[model samples]
Structure formats: structure tokens, C-alpha cells
Target: MEAKSERAERAAQNELLFRAVNEQILQMTERFRAQLSDIDIVCECAVASCVGTIRITAEEFVRIRRETGTFFVLAGHEDTDVEDVVGRRNGYVVVRKQAVAADA
Candidate 1:
């Protein structure tokens, strides 16, 4: 079993990676303002092996960015022990990592 701290570290790293991908996608999307619609974003789950992507509208992504602790993951990717489901969409779920993990 993974230790709590290790899990938190992994989760934090995944979140950071997801954020980086999001930023890249945002930059690319900005160049096509007239065609902007649903954007593909990396699933920000703690699972290091996960390579899934979630599609969300640009507005939804902006709302998630308003809060640092929140993340968008595939519908079933949430680790209940380290995060809580704050919202649900058609193909994805919004999770807010626990304080300890969120701060990592």
C-alpha cells in the first residue's frame, strides 16, 4: 500500500502536470478565438499511469482555475481518500483535493 505522504506527493505532482497541460492548451486555443468551444484537457487525477483526457468548455475551465485546489478528472478517477467530488459533468468530475494533498 502506498503511504499517505507518498500518495499526496504523487497527487500534487499530477495536479501540477495537469495544470501545465491546461496552460498549454489554453495558449493554443487563444490563437483560435473564433473557433473556441470544448477544449481537451488532461485528467488531473492522482494516478500517475493515467493518460486520459477530459473535454470541457473553456468557461468551465476558467471557473476551475479560479480555485487552485480544484481539479478536473475523468468521471471515475477520483481518489475519495484524498479528494472530494465538488461537481460532476457528462464525461468528467471536479475534485477538490484534501488540504494536505492540495498544499503539497
Candidate 2:
């Protein structure tokens, strides 16, 4: 239905915005060479109102970023209708947007 596509589009836009923010965070972290044991980054969820943070190491984030269009979110924050869980860590999970499913 049209409503579902609209929801998916909205979710994609929100997630993309968060992903861009997270990329900036990573750039800052790498530029400073902070060597932090763990960094608190915003949850890359689709919820526009979500202000949650997920704790993860710089290296871990880089590893997850190796894949295109992936996001890191809190375990229960993932919306299966929009993304597919690709990896799971202690407190977070990596997800990839499902092209067909999300648009369906």
C-alpha cells in the first residue's frame, strides 16, 4: 500500500540522517586518534525521535561500516520490516536495509 511505502521512505530518511551523524563522529574519533576503549554513538535506528546511544569501539564500528548501507542499533530497536539483522554484539546489532521489503 501507499502508506507502507511512505513509512519506509520516512524511516530510510531518518536512518540516513543518523548514519551521516555517526560518520562524522567516526571521522572525529579517527582524526583525534582517541584510542577509546569504547565510544558512545547515537543509535542508527529509523525512529526520528530516538535519542538512544549505543556503546561500541571504534574498530568495531569500522568493521560494521565495511558493508554498505548498514546501521548499528540497540538490539530491541531494530525494525525488521525495514532492515535485516546482519550482526549482533553484546548490546547492539548491525542491520542492512532490505530494498524490496522496505519498499513493499
Candidate 3:
């Protein structure tokens, strides 16, 4: 039936979209990993939350983080934590810089 064919077509299109999004995320994550290899990397959803080790300076990190995205609806509000958003969306890789401990 025409209806059945239409539904199938829609499903296929949706699948393709999903695949594209997944690929984008994978690519971005890989780039982040490579760029911040000196630090730990955690792939997380914007809501679920994760951590990564970052060797870059705080200024650099802040700049990179700001450039990440201007809009994050999944984060639920303005000034939402990037880690939280990445965790919720499961669409971004976060690079966290671990705090160094002072020697005793």
C-alpha cells in the first residue's frame, strides 16, 4: 500500500539522520580525544555527566568550551554546565583537567 511505502521511507530517512548524528558525535569525540590526549577523556551525555583530564590551561579550556555550542536545550537553562549538557545529550566528549594535588 502507498501508506506502507511512505512509512517505510520515513523510517529509512530517520535511520539515516540518526546515523549521521552518531557519526558527527563520534568524529567530534575523536577530535577532542586527540587534542586533549594529555588529559583523560570521558564520553558522556549532557545529562548523565562524565569527566576528563585536560592539560590545556584554564583560559584555553574556557575558550574551547565556550566555542562548543551556543544553544543547549537539553541542559535546561542558561549557564548550564557543559559537562551536564554533554552527559544529557550523549552527543559530546568532555575533557576535564584534573586538579593537581600539592605535595605534603
Candidate 4:
């Protein structure tokens, strides 16, 4: 079995990667002066090979980014083994990693 700390680390890493991708996308779209409506965001799941994308409003993305422990994931992509589902939207879900993962 994987150690709790290891799982947490993995989950944190996955979230970090997802956030990096989202930040890049944001920068690319910033110049367009796009309205704060629907935007495409990478899935913030604990799977290294995942390439899924979820659509979320820019305002929603900003809200999720404000919380360090919370991540926006595609529907059904949440890893319940490492995180808890905190909110569900029409096309995405918000997950908060366990405290150990959050600390990492």
C-alpha cells in the first residue's frame, strides 16, 4: 500500500501541474480581453496521464484559485481516495485534498 504521505505528495504534485497549465492558458487568453464567461481548464486530478479538459466560467476559475487546497476537476475525475468532493457544478466538480496533501 502507498504511504499516506506519498499519496499526499502525489496529489499535491498533480494539483500543481494542473494549476501551471491553467495559468499558462490564462496568460494566453488575457490579451483577448475575453469576458469572464466560459473558459477551458485542465482537469485537476491525481492522474499523470490525464488530458481531460473542463469548461468553467472565468469567475469560477478565479474563485477556485483563491483557495489553496481546493481544485477544479472535470466531472467524475475526482480521486476520492485522496480528496473530498466539496462542490459540484454542471460540468465540473471542486475537490479539496486531505489536510496532509494540502500541507504539501
**Pick by lDDT: which candidate is best?**
1
Which stretches in model 4 have alpha-carbon errors above 4 Å?
Answer: 100-104
In model 3, the Cα lDDT at residue 39 comes to 31
Q: Supply the TM-score for candidate 3.
A: 0.29
lDDT of 4: 0.83
Q: Rank by lDDT, descending? A: 1, 2, 4, 3
Candidate 2 C-alpha lDDT tens digits along 47-79: 889999998888888888777768899889998
Local accuracy of candidate 1 as per-residue lDDT tens digits, 1-104: 98987887888888878888898998889878579888898898887788999888888898887886889989999988888898998989998878844576
Clashing pairs in 2: none
Per-residue CA lDDT of candidate 4, range 14-85, in tens? 888988999888777776646546779889888888898998777778877887788888888888878889
User: Candidate 4, residue 68: CA error in Å?
Assistant: 1.8
Model 4: worst 10 consecutive residues (lDDT sum): 29-38
TM-score of 2: 0.85
Query: Global lDDT of each model?
Result: 0.85, 0.84, 0.32, 0.83
